[model samples]
Target: MRIGEVLHMNGGNGDSSYANNSLLQQNVILMTKPITEEAITSLYSSLSNPKSISIADLGCSSGPNTLLAVSNLVKAVDNHRKKLRRRHSPEFQIYLNDLPTNDFNTIFQSLPKHRREIAGDGSGLCFFNGVPGSFYGRLFPTDSLHFVHSSYSLHWLSQVPKGIEENKGNICMAAYYDQFEQDFSTFLKCRSKELVKGGRMVLTMQGRPSQNPTCHLWELLALALNEIVAEGFAEEEKLNSFNVPLYTPSLAEAKLVVEKEGSFSIECLEASQIYWTGYNGSDDYEVNSGYGVARSVRAVAEPMLVSHFGEGIIDELFHKYTEMIVDSISTRPETTQFTNVIVSVIKM
Candidate 1:
C-alpha cells in the first residue's frame, strides 16, 4: 500500500480527529521548545538581521499542535529581534507541509485566528502557505529556507520496507534498521539542499533508549490485533501482511546518519522519556484511565487500519486496545513511556 495515499491523521474537529487527540505530540513540542527557540535565536543572529525569513515545518499535520509550533518559532524569532533592538522584526514566509492527503483545510480554517494572534503580538507580516508533498524528496527551491522545524513526524518512513513479508503477527517495524538509515539519510540530503548555509533545523521524533528499535506501545497494539484475529473478526492474512511504516531509532542510529550525511553539523541531540498518556499529573481522570492513550493511537493509526482491515473492526479493536493498555499499565507501569529524540542541526 502507498503510505502517502492512505496515511493521515483523522481529519476535522471531531472527537476522534488528530486535532483534538494530539496532546502527546503537543507535549513533545512543549518539551522541545527550548531547543527550538535556541536554534532560531542562533540562526537569526548568524543571519545578521536579514529583512525576511523563510521557515518550513515539514510533516506539519493539522491541529493546534501545528499552529503551536509555528507560534513558538515566530515568538522566539521576534523576541530575539527585540533583544537586538531592531526597529522591526523580519517578515516571515512560513510553509506548512505534509502529504497530499493531509487535512490542510483544517489548518487553513484556523489561520485567521492564528494570524490575528501573531498580528496582535506585532510580529510583522507573516505569509502562510500549504505545501502538500513528502519530505523525503525536495519541496522547495535551493537555499530557500532559513529555519525548519518538525516534531513527531520523521519516524514515519517514506514507505514500508521492501522485505519483511514474514514479519507477521507483529505490526511494529522494529527490525528494519537498514531501511531507516536509508530513509533518514535521504531526509537529511533533501533538507540540506533546501536550507540556506547556516540555516537551522530542530526535529523531535519517537526514539528508543537501546539499540533495539522496538516500541512497546506498538507491541501492545499488535497484541490487540492478534487477539481480534483469533476471534475471527478479521483475517489473519491481513494482519500478517500489515506492518506499520514506522521506526523508532536509537540516539546512536540517528547520530550516525547525521554524521554520515555530512551536510549539517549537529547542534544538539538528546532523548527524553514521555509518558504514554502524555500527561504526568494525575489531574486528568481520562488520561489516568488509559482511554486517552487509546484515543491518541486511534487518531493516528485509524486511517491506515481502515485502509487495510476495513472500518468494521476499529471500535472493537480500540476497545480491546484500551483494556490491554490499562492492564499493561497496572502490571508494568515502568514500561508505559515513549522515548523521544530531539535533534538540532545547522546546515553546513
Candidate 2:
C-alpha cells in the first residue's frame, strides 16, 4: 500500500476525530516533557544564546497535542531566557510537519489562538509554517534547523515491508527488524544534514521491551479483525493481505542503528510505560474502559483501515475489537500498558 497516500489520523474535532481522542498521545507528550525541554535548553546554551531558533516537529499530526508540544518547547526556551536574564527572547521559526494528507488546515486555523496564548505569556515572537511530507526522507534545507522533535511517528515504515504476504493473521510487521533499521538509519542521515552543527533532536515512540515485537494491543486488533472475517463481515483474503506499517523496536535495536549511522551522538535513551487508558494516577472507568481505548485506536487507525478494508466494515470491526479488549483486560489488566522509548541525540 502507498502509506503516504493512505496514512493519516482522522481529522477535525468530531467525536471520532484524532483531535478529540488523542488524550493518550497528549499524555505521552506530557510524560516526555522533561527530556524534550532539557534537550532544547542544552542546545540553546551550547549556541551561546542565538537571536533566532528554528525547530521542526516531524509527524506533527493535528490536534491539541500538536500545539501542546510546540507550546512546551517554546515555554522551555522562554523560561531559560528569563533564567539567564537575557534582554530579549529568541525569535522562533516553527515548522509543523506531517504527511501530505494530514489536517494542516485545522492546525492553521487554530494558530490565531495559539499565537495569542504565546503572546499572553510574554514569550518570544513566533512564526509558524506547515510542512506536509514524509519524514523518512529529507524535509528541511541543509543546516537550517536547530532542534527536531517527533513523537509516536517514527515507528511507521515508509512502506510495507517486502515478503510479508505469507505472514497471515497478523497486522503488525513485528518480524521484520531489517526494515526498521533501514528506515531509522535513513531518518538519522536526513536529520543530520538538516540540523546545524551542535543541533539536537528528541524522539519518542512505541517500543518493545526486548527483541520480541509482541504488541498486546495489536494482537487484540488482529483477533478482532479475524472475528470480523469469520462473521462474514469482511473477506479473509483481505485480512491476510493487510498489515500495519509499524515496527516498535527494542532499545538495543534503536541504539545499534544510531551507532551504525554515525551521524549523531546518543545523549540519552530510556524507556517508560503508559497505560492504554492514558491514566497517570487513579484510574477512571470512563477513561480506562475498553470503549475509551478502542476509540483512541480508531482515531489513529481508521483512515488507513478505510483505505484498505472499505468503510463498511470499520464500525463492526471496532465494535468487536472493543469487546475483545474488555475481555482481555479483565483477564490480564497488568498487560494494558504500552512501552515507550524516548531518545535525545546531538549532531556529532
Candidate 3:
C-alpha cells in the first residue's frame, strides 16, 4: 500500500489516539528542544530587527506532541525579543504540514484554545494554518519559510524502498539503503526550494546505531507478528506482503544524504538513545513499560496494520506485542532503546 494514502497516527483524543500515547515522541521533542531553540535563535539573529517570521513544522502528526516543538520555537522567539527589549515580537505565520490523510481537524480544533493561551501570554501575533500534503515535495511558495522544524519524523520514506525483493518477516525498510538515501536527498532538495536564503531547518528523525542498523524494538514487533502468523492468526502470505514504509537511517547516512543533496549545509547532526517507554522513574518500568511501548507503537503503526491485517487483529496483535515487549525488557533491557538523530541545517 502507498504510505501517503494510508499512513496516519490514530486521530482524536480517544484512548487509542496518538494524542494519548505519544510519550516516546514527546520525550524526543523535549530532548531536541535545545537544538530547536538554538536554530531559531541563530535564524533570528541573522535578521536585523525582524518583524515577522514564517515557520513550518513538517510531518506534524496530530497529537499533543504536535504543537510542542512549534510552541518552543515561538517561546524562544518571544524570549529573544524580551532580551533585545524590542517593542514588538515578530509576527509568526506557522504552517503545520502533514500527509493529506492526517488528522488535520483535530489540529484545527485545538487551535482556538491554543490561540487564546498564546494571546494571554502576550507573546506575539501568530497565525496558524494546516497544510495537508507530503513533505517530499514543495508545500509552499518560493522563499516563503524562514525556519522549519520536524521531530520524530523524516525517517519515513515517501514509499517503500525499491531494489529489495524480500525483507521476509522484517517490515522495516532497512534492506534498501540506496533507495532510502535517494528519497532523502529528494526530500531535502524539495525543502531547499521553499526556504529563503539563510533559512534553517531543524529535524529529529528515528535512527539506528551505526554499529547496528536494526533497531531491536521493531525487530521485536516483527517477532510478535511472526508468532501470530505461526498460530494461524495471520496468513503467511499476508505477512509477507506487509511492510512498514519507514527506515531508521544512521547518523552517517543522514549526513551523507544532506551532503549529497548539496542544497543545505548541515550545522549539527547528533544521535541520542531513548527508551521505548520514555520511562521517567515515576512509573513502574516492568509493569507499565510494555504497555507504554505497545501504545506508542499502536498509535503510529495501527493504520498500516489495519490496512493489511484487517481491523480485527489490532487489539489482539498489540496485546501479543505487549507480552513480547515485556519478555524482551525482562531479558535484555538494552534492547528496548532506539537512537534518534537530530539534525540542524542552514540553507546556503
Question: What is the C-alpha local distance difference test score of each model?
Answer: 0.90, 0.90, 0.85
Q: Distance (Å) between predicted and true CA of 94, model 2?
A: 0.2
lDDT of 1 by residue, 161-254 (tens): 8888767799877667777889999999999999999999999989998986678889989999999999999999999999999999899889
Q: What is the C-alpha lDDT profile of model 3 across 152-198, one tens digit per residue? A: 77888787766553567877754657767877887788889899999
Question: What TM-score against the true fold does each predicted structure earn?
Answer: 0.97, 0.97, 0.96
Which of the predicted structures, 1 or 3, would earn the higher TM-score when compared with the native? Answer: 1
* Candidate rank order under TM-score: 1, 2, 3
lDDT of 1 at 317: 97
Question: Which window of ten consecutive residues has the lowest lDDT sum in model 1?
Answer: 278-287
lDDT of 2 by residue, 1-348 (tens): 789988899999998999989988999999999999999999877877688999999999998988888888999998988988887889899999999999999999999999999888888889999998889899999999999999999988888889887557889866667888999999999999999999999999899887777888889999999999999988888999898888898898899999999999999999999888854344645335788889999998998889889999999999888888888777888888889988999998
Count of clashing residue pairs in every prediction: 0, 0, 0
Cα lDDT over the full model 1: 0.90
Q: Which ten residues in a row are the worst by lDDT in model 2? A: 278-287
Which residue ranges in model 2 land beyond 4 Å of their true spot?
279-288
